[model samples]
Target chain A: MTQPIEKIETPKGERFIIPIGPQHPALKEPGHFEFTVDGETVKDATVRLGYVHRGIEKATESRNYIQNLYLLERICGICSHTHAMTYSLGVEKLAGVEAPPRAQAIRVIVAELERIHSHMLWLGVAAHEAGFDTLFMYSWRDRETVMDLLELLSGNRVNYSANVLGGVKFDITPEQAGDVLKGLDFLEGRNRHYLDVVSNDALLLGRIRGVGVMTQADAERLGAIGPTARASGVALDVRIDAPYIAYKDFQPALITETAGDLEARFKVRVREIEESIRLIRLLLEHLPEGELVARMPRRIPAGEAISRVEAPRGEAFYFIKSNGTDTPARVKVRTPTIFNMATVLSLAKGLQLADMPMILVGIDPCFSCNDRMVTVREAERAETWTWNELREHGIKVYQR
Target chain B: MSNLVDQITAGLKTWARVNSPWVIHFNSGSCNGCDIEILATLTPRYDLERFGVKLQGSPRHADVLVCTGPVTRQARERLIRIYEQMPEPKFVVAVGSCAVSGGVFEGCYNVMGGIDRVIPVHAFIPGCPPRPEAIIDGVVKLLSSLQSPAPVQPIMGPDGGKA
Candidate 1:
């Protein structure tokens, strides 16, 4: 399905070079891409990232397994649990310790909750980008209900620090369980309203439909994943494909869309949120009775294993190479944003400059958690402009 | 239709400016330590809005700029642009260990070390993305600082109107 990079000549002799992001209001992360355009069509695009690289991979080498859990959580605030979950699974495999059944269930619950929060957040951002301000406000306000539930379960709201090496650090009581159920019920109803807004809203559909079209073949060739790949009819989700944690016990329902556009991605995420709600209900009902933590090994064995978790974003893969120590010898993370960023540039081409914000925010690039920039030359001559200068320049040109 | 009405209007404006601070966040390139904490403040636990702080999407509509990460070479210009877009009388709050001193990324290439190199930082909230409570505390402290009136300009001597 890989399409060769083709070049098309246009009537206009001058080539169009559109540089998007690195500091765009539409993008939450910092990554830049330059698209070569001919007339209104995108001819080619080159992506440039590493703007928010903090050298976390190198920093991980210095921290122990316990410390690395916090470091991994810092990877992405929304998918903090998945990072810790995958890291713990990888290290546990090396240490030869299976988490207790109760702990496993708790992990599943937390992971699903994280997925719910992430998708709702994405929905709000996407809505905001498409100029649907009311949807943005409602979605973000609804997301707080899930955050409150998570806070009730674990002490912290964002970084729950629930996942440990052998088991979860916290447990839920009967009262807390009731609160969670009530929250979920409220979310379920609110989600239905969201579905109506996303599906039928004329403005949203107009902006997203038929925009940023990526073929199934293009997605596979680029290794696009999560909703991005699924939206392109690639039925690939790590939770179902490679079962990990309690996902093996309760498989997640994979949602796919054949039409690969912004609307398709939106549909996939919305459907997944519903699936997560159902999964959470089923998990809470089938709560197994057992101890939370098993005995964890003091030292890990000298071996390497790869663990992948379907984070809210996509397949969050963690490669842990242990050397029979409390700290790992090598730990590498392949976040989903790294792969999806490529598709953002591709989809951005041929689209009007005004539509760029919606397309950029659709991928939800977590540049801060992933890449670190490396300056090649200290004395390189590059033109720099301030925000005021750019705004003034833009105003002058647009006013005319 | 008098001086009383004008005084009341000015008082309301001052009160709104002090109570409701709209913050625009910019990530120059540090580890996401501070950004998470900033978001945490918005959650129900901290409920930063109850204190009248709100997160804004664009710099033009912002009253305060909460910046995280050590400014890297790639992000330096962008950071400056975002800062300049904001209106005057704006305050800058640098959050996290990285934003304060670049923390571990201080000596690394691409990193400019601290956010102050690019923008005028009004306050520093330290801690690898200081705790949520700490972020709230920092914002509150920044508000208190803004409450103080500007220092009177030094009177110039009659000789050439120079100090």
Candidate 2:
């Protein structure tokens, strides 16, 4: 059943309350928005999140630095390496250890590979939201090549646990190096096709051209980063601005667009896939030869540091505070989604309900990664229910 | 006529099992722990379709529900509603450490802890995200259980399946 768009007048003026999420189909995560509209135009928007809060920061305090790498990678699967890399850098700083040049180079390669995978995934999602199912299928199919490369490099597909305290856990052998080159070659070919589809597709252009426009000043003020910020003409990229991992060795191309529309966001991601391809090629050619790991002290001194890496999403921040123990005192991860989600309320105001999902997916907010769960009520009734209770009553009833 | 009817029923159930798996992804309020992993399965790497397991946009079309996150108070009612929307012979696969037993979100205020508190989970896929392969394995296991003639196991309330 569709509810008619209703408007209510306040002391200020007539304002329509448009609910965008919490249960909306547009968002992959669970977050709600109430937009005050005036005749198909958005006057103001209010965002309500914390729907999926899971208390990861609190969970991090109990775990040690080494264990935290695995936990941190869970921040966002699309940009898993950025979390691991940033966390490692923070801990390395506390330990006063520098990763070997070779390790740094490999980190850059994997990180770039992650960017390619993530951006490709976003392209597919954006395409799907735009009702371009073929593009979605094609882009996702090609994304497998990147994932295969990641699997080849680090044994696993998603959370590669490749990054360690002083350096990376895995090393690239001569055979692996050849495999990397071959993977890059295959991706170079597939990317051209992807670019062709994204750049020339008429239907996709019409859907995203002027949708969810964000001005440069507003994007900066709202703390937008990554493709969302770049789409608004922000030239800031952690890889180029700060230069972590092997990014310092080989500079990555910072792709930006001034349009600040959904189309521009699409262009930025597509261009980034190209730049990532370039960065990987450069790293492969100039890869330094040395040990992948560096010797380090067991206990990190009592010090605090913040490290930021340019994830495919945007600036992934990791703040680590140590207290002279293996277990960290505090570890706070401020993901790119947190900043990107802020722009959703603003963008949703002027858009139709149908356009909401496309715009939401455009930011690619990893709601699951950002939200933490909190208990609000106490359990008044307790029954030591067995599996049988579930099988007979709960299972059968819910099943039908 | 009876034999023909049996054949048609078998074919329809098989078609339904492969084509639709009605998924109810529960957040239970996690640190986005298993959420990304679940997303990963839908992405290119694991491409969940080879098994005919498609992520249902809503609970109504879902025959298999996948719940992530710990069971938080805010998500309880919404989770129950989504589960109730699916037709009969549904399977709930709880993914992640949080969904299984609240993982790290156990002591948090907003969370009711494990998902078993609110819904009947047919299978548990453990891990921060339970790796894509593990997710596929869990779904396959659930599918096989659904195909079997044994009675479905309950997750909560008295007279339910034993923990």
Over the stretch A1-400, how does candidate 2's per-residue lDDT look in tens digits? 1112232223345544544445321122456665565554556677776655555677777777777787677655567788889999989988888999999998888998988888887787677656676887777777778877898999776778889999999888878878888887888888888777666777677777888899999898988888999999999899899987687769987799999998889888988888988888888878898899999896789999888888888887888898898789988777777688788877876575455556767887652222111111123321221111211221122223
- Candidate 2: where are CA atoms >4 Å away? A1-15, A23-30, A367-400, B1-21, B30-54, B101-114, B127-134, B151-163
CAPRI tier for the interface of model 2: acceptable
* Docking outcome class, model 1: incorrect
lDDT of 1 by residue, B1-163 (tens): 6899998987676678779989988877754546655765775546799988888556778888888877777677767877888997688888887777776566555566777666677788887657778888888877776656761121211232110
Over 4 Å off, model 1: A1-13, A23-30, A366-400, B1-23, B30-63, B70-90, B96-121, B124-137, B149-163
All candidates: TM-score: 0.80, 0.82
For candidate 1, write residues A1-400 as lDDT tens digits.
1111123233455555655444432122456666565554556677776555666677677788888888778666678898899999998888888999889999999999999988888887567556576776677778888978898899766778899889999887778888888998999999988888777888678778888899999999888988889999999999999898788889888899999988888988888889999998888888888888888878888999999989888898889898887778899898887788888777766665445556656776642222111111123422233222322332332233
Model 2 Cα lDDT, one tens digit per residue, B22-126:
565655555443665576677666877767667644456677778876766666777788788788867787888877887655665556767787878888888
- Top-scoring candidate (DockQ): 2
Determine the C-alpha RMSD for candidate 2 after optimal superposition of all C-alphas. 8.4
Tell how far residue A291 is off in model 2, in angstroms: 1.6
